[model samples]
Target chain A: MTHHTASAEELEALARHARWLVLSTVADAGAGHIGGPLSQMDLLLALYFNHLRIDPSDPHRDDRDRFVLSKGHTAIGLYTVLALRGYFDPAELATFDHGDSRLQGHPDMRMLPGIDASTGSLGQGLSVAVGMALGARLQQRDFHTWVLLGDGEIEEGMVWEAAYAASRYGLDNVTAIVDRNGLQQYGWPAGASDRFDRRDPWAGKDVGAIFRGFGWDVIDIDGHDHAEIDRALETACGARGSAGRPTVILAETVKGKGVSFTEGTYRWHNGIATADQLAAARAELGQPETVGVAR
Target chain B: MIAQRQVWGETLVELGASDDRIVVVDGDLANSTKADLFAAAHPERFVEVGIAEQNMVGIAFGLSTLGYRPWLSTFGVFLTHRALDPIRMLVSQTGAAVRIAGAYSGLLNGRSGKTHQDVADLAIMRTMPGMTVLAPADEHEMRAAVRWAADHDGPLYLRIARDAVAPVFDIDTTWEDWAPRMLRDGGDITVVSTGVQTSRCVDAVRLLADRGIDARHIHVPMLKPLDEDRLAGLLGERVVTVEEHTMIGGLGGLVAEIVAARRSTQTVTRLGLADGWSESGPDAFLLDKYGLSASRIADRIVGVHSRPVGTPGV
Candidate 1:
C-alpha cells in the first residue's frame, strides 16, 4: 500500500478546517463539545488525514489501521475529521446534534461508518484497542490500532487496568494519544486558576510519567504543532511491535487552541457559544462570514 | 451429582480441547469460580486480570471481537454489579458472543456472607435486552447450558451455585432445550424452582405426594426466556416459586413478571431471602432460616393448600 506524507502546512490547513467545522457544527447543533475537540483537532488531523490506513469508499476494509475515540463526547471533532477524510459528506457536519442525525452525542460504532469502537463512557477505548492489536497478532495482520484519550479520562481505574494488560501482553501495535489539555468537565485548568492549588484540573498528574510507569513507550509533544504530531505518530507507528511496549504519545494541548476566548479554560468543554462568540470563532478560523454555511 | 461450577470448569476443558477459539478470563477468583481448572489446563488461552473485575470484562469483551469465544468467570455479585456498565455497553449493546459464568451464587456462598451472596443476579441479568440468562438445576444441565452458550451467539449469563447438588435428571437425557422442563405433573398446584432450589422442590414434591397434594414440579434452568406458556398450562390457578435468591429480583421476580403478564389471575407464591442483609452462618442453617429447605418448602406448600381461603401461608 502506497502512503503519502501530507506536508505540515497541508495538515495544519486541514486541522484549521476541522477546527472551523467543529466551531460551526457545535454552534449549529446547539449541543456539542468544543474545548477538547478544538485542542485535539491537530492530532486528529495528523492521524486521520496523514496516517490512518482507511479508505472512505470501503470504510470497513480489513487491513486498515483502526482508531478509537475514547473521549467520545468530542465526536464533533472526530465526525468532522471523518467527513474531511471523505468517510461522509463534509456538509453533514451541520447536522451534528440534530435529532435524526447519525452524529450522536457520543461516538456510536453501530450508528456511524468508519468508527472502530463505540465509546462514550470514559476510559474504555484503550482496552478495545488492546484487543484490536491482539487481533492483529492472532490473525497475523500488520495493522496498528490508535486510541485518542483525554488526560482527565485517565482518572478512570479501567484505564490503568488496560495500560497494565497492554504491557503485560506486550501489544506494541497499540498506540494511545492523550490530549493533555489540562482541563476536564471542571473548567479550572492547572494554571487557569489557583482553586486547584496550582495543579491541573486532572489532579496535577504527570501524563508522560503515568504511561511510562505502565510500561509504555512515552512521547511528549506539543499537541497544537502538526509537525510534532506527525513526527510522534510516525515514530509510534514505526516502532510498533519492535518497541516491546505499547506506545503512548502525551501531547500537551491548550483546552481550546484556535479561539482565544475559549482557550485554556474549562467552561468551553461543553460551553454554549453565543451568536457573537460563534462569529468571533469564524473570524479566528478565517471562514466566510456566513451563519451556518451550507456545506 | 456434582457442583455446577465444577462441571463448568470441566466442560471448559472439554470445549477447550475441541475448540481453539475458546478462551477463559478470570478475575483473580479462578479457584473459587472454578476457572482455574481452565487456566491450568490451557494456560495459553486463559487470562488472569488480577483483582480488577471491570478490566476482566473489558478485556474479555475486546477479546470476543477477535473471533475468540470468551467465558469470563467470577462471583455473580461482581460480574453483575462491579462491571455491569461495561457488560451493558460493550457486550450487550454490541451484542458480542461472550459467555459469562456468574459463579458462587445464592445461598451456596453463604459462608462469604452478604457481600458475596448473590441474590439479585437473575433480576439484574434478566433485564439486559440481549442477555440469555440461564441457571441450571444440576451438573448435567450446567454442562448442556455451557455448551449451548458456546454455540449460541450474543451475550449469555449462566448463573451457577457453588454446592454440589442431587441430580434430578440423568446426563443422558437431551439437556439442550431452554424451556422449563416438567419433572412432575399435577393439577392441584405447580412448584417451579431452579438451582439447588430445584432439588428442594423435588423433596417437597415427594413429601406432598405422600400427603396426596399432587403438586406439579417444573425445573426452570433458563430464567430469562422462561416457558411462560407451559408453566401457565400446568399452574392450575395456584403456583409456588422456590429459589435461593432474594425475593425481589431472582427467580421469584421473574416468575411473578411472567405469570402477571401471561396469567394475571393465577395466584403466585414466592419464597426466598427477605429484603434485609444476611449474616454469616452454616449453609443449611441459612437455607432453613429463609424457608428454602426441602422440609420447609413442603410445609409451606401444605399450609397453603390446606388453607380454605386459598391465601398464602408463609
Candidate 2:
C-alpha cells in the first residue's frame, strides 16, 4: 500500500481533467451537483491515476479493487476518473445527463463499466462493499473494496445498520471514507435538522469513536491533503490483515474547495452554474479552450 | 395434498445446503411458515427477527448487501402490509436480490380471521418495480421456484397458501425455473390460473369437459413480466382468469392489460376474491362462500359459453 507518486505533470493533468469533466458535464446538462463533485475531484483523480489497482481497458478484471461512490449525486468526479482510466471514451463525458446516456445523474453498474455497485439511494453502498469484500475473502482474492460516502448521507438509518454488520463480520477488506463537508441539501446538517444538533457536526459526532466502538480501526484525515490521505490508506491496508477489524476514514473536506464564490455554501451543493459563473469557474481552474493532454 | 407454504420452507432448506450463501430469515413464525428446517441446518445463516416484519425486511436488505442471498418468510398480511416501503426502496431502488416468501395468503389462513387472511399480497407485490412475482400452482412448483430463486440474482416475492390442497403438478415436473407451463389444452377458451387456485381451476375444467365444454388452461408461476406473448397465443377469443388473490392487481389484472392492448375479439371473465375482509372460519368454508370452488367455476364457464356461438357473455 505504499504511495506510488504520479509525476507532477500527470497529477496536474488528471486534476485538470477531473475539474473540467464535472464543469463541462454540468454545463452540458442543465443541472448537476456542483460542490461535492468539485471537493472530491482530487481524491478521485489520485485514486484512479496513482493507487487503484484497475485496468481501464479491462473493466471486469477479476483481481481489480472495487470502488463504489455511495454518494452518487457527486458522480461527475468518479465518471471523469473512469474515463481517464480508459473505462470509456473521454468524449462520452459530454453526454452526461442527456437522454439514453450511460453517464446518468447517478452511477449505474449495468450501464457503465468499472462501477462495482449501482447506487443513488444512500446508506446501501457500504453494505454492498462489505459483500464484495466478503466475496473476495471467501475466494481468497487479494482485492479490496472501497466506498466513498457523503457526510449528509449518514442521516440514513441503514448506514448505521451496515456499520454494525460490517463490524460484526470483521470485514477488514472493506474501507469507507466519509467526505465530511458539513452542508447538506437544504442547509447545514444542524440547520436542516430538528432532531439532532452539533457545532462542527462532522467532528462533534465522533464518527471515529462510533466505528471504534463497533470494533473498526478508525482513521481521521484531511481529504485534500494528499500525503495524509496516502498514509491513512497505507495504515488501513496493514490494519486490514491484523485479525478482524475494518477501517473507516473520516475525511474532512471543504465543499467547493477551489472555487471562491461557491466554497462552503449550502446553495452551491447543487449549484446550477450560470453562463457567467461557468466562464469564471473555468478561468480559475485554468481550463484551456481546446482539450488535449491537459498540459 | 401438500400446501404451497410447506414447499417454500422445504425447498429453501434443500437449496441452503448446496448454496451456503443462501440464508433464511423469519419474523417469529418459523414454525408456522415451516422454515424451522432451514434454521436447524444452517443455524448461522437462519435469523429469527422476532415479530418485526418491517425491521426483518430492512435486515434482509442489509444481508443482501453483504453478498448473502436472504429468503425472508412471513405471513402475507405482515410481509406485504408492514414492510412494503422498505422492500420497495431497498430491493427495487437499490437492486438487491432478496427473496420474500409470503405464506398464508389469499383466504388460506384458515380460522385466522379478517386481520390474518391476506387477499392484498398479490396486488401489493405485483406493483413493485424490479420485483418478480411467483405464484406457484402446487407444492412441486413452489419448491422449484424456491430453488430457482437461490441461483437467480434479483428481488422475488412469492405468495403461498396455507391449506393442504391436492397437488396439481407431477412430482417429477420441473416448474421451479419460473417458466410458465401449459397444463391442459383446448381451442374454445383459455383459463389462466395461479397459486393454489390453479388446482381448483383444473377440477373446474374436468367438470366442464363432462358437460362437453372445451377449454385451455395455461398455468403461470411467474406473475411479473407476465408472459404476454405466451398468454396472447393461448387466449383466443374467449378467456377466463382465476386466482385466490384479489382480481384488481392479480392475474386477472395482468392478463387484462395484454388482452386490451391486442384488442383481440377475446372476452375475459375474471374469477377471484371480491374486495372485502372476511370473518374467521376454515379456508374451505371461506372458499365456498367466496365462490372459489370448482363447482361454482364450472357453472360460471357453462353459463358464459352457453350465451352465444360467436359472442362472449359479460
Q: Chain A alone, model 1, TM-score?
A: 0.93
Q: On residues B1-314, what C-alpha lDDT tens digit does candidate 1 reach at each position?
A: 68888999999998999887888888888998788899889988887777777777777777776678889888878989988888888888888887888899887684888888878888898889888888888888888888777778788998888988788777855564788878988978888888778987898899999888998898888887766777666566678888888888777777777777874676778877778878678878887888888888899888777766456423
- Model 2 chain A poorest 10 in a row by lDDT: A191-200
Q: Across the candidates, what are chain A's individual TM-scores?
A: 0.93, 0.90
Q: Local error of candidate 1 at B203, Å?
A: 1.5
Per-residue lDDT for A64-109 in model 2, tens only?
7778898989987788878877788888887888889999798877
- Candidate 1 lDDT over A1-295, as tens digits, reads 3255578878777776778888877877778889889988889888877788878888778888889899988988899889988889888777787878788899887788888888888888887888777767866889989999998898888899889988988888999999988778874425644332224745545667777888988999999887788789999999876888899998988877898888867778886777888778878877766634353
lDDT of 1 at B286: 83
lDDT string, candidate 2, B1-314, tens digits: 77777777777777877787887777779888888878887787776656666556656765575578888878878878876766766677666888888888887686888888778787888889888988887887777777777777889888888877778877866653455667899877778888888889999999998999888888888888666787688776787888887878788888887888987777887888777767788766877888788988888778777766556423
Question: Against the true structure, what is model 1's DockQ?
Answer: 0.59
* DockQ, all models: 0.59, 0.11
Score each candidate by Cα lDDT.
Answer: 0.82, 0.76
- Which candidate leads the pack in lDDT? 1
Model 2 misplacement above 4 A: A1-3, A7-13, A49-51, A187-217, A291-295, B12-36, B39-132, B147-157, B175-191, B203-218, B224-230, B236-238, B275-314
Show the colliding residue pairs in model 2. B144-B176
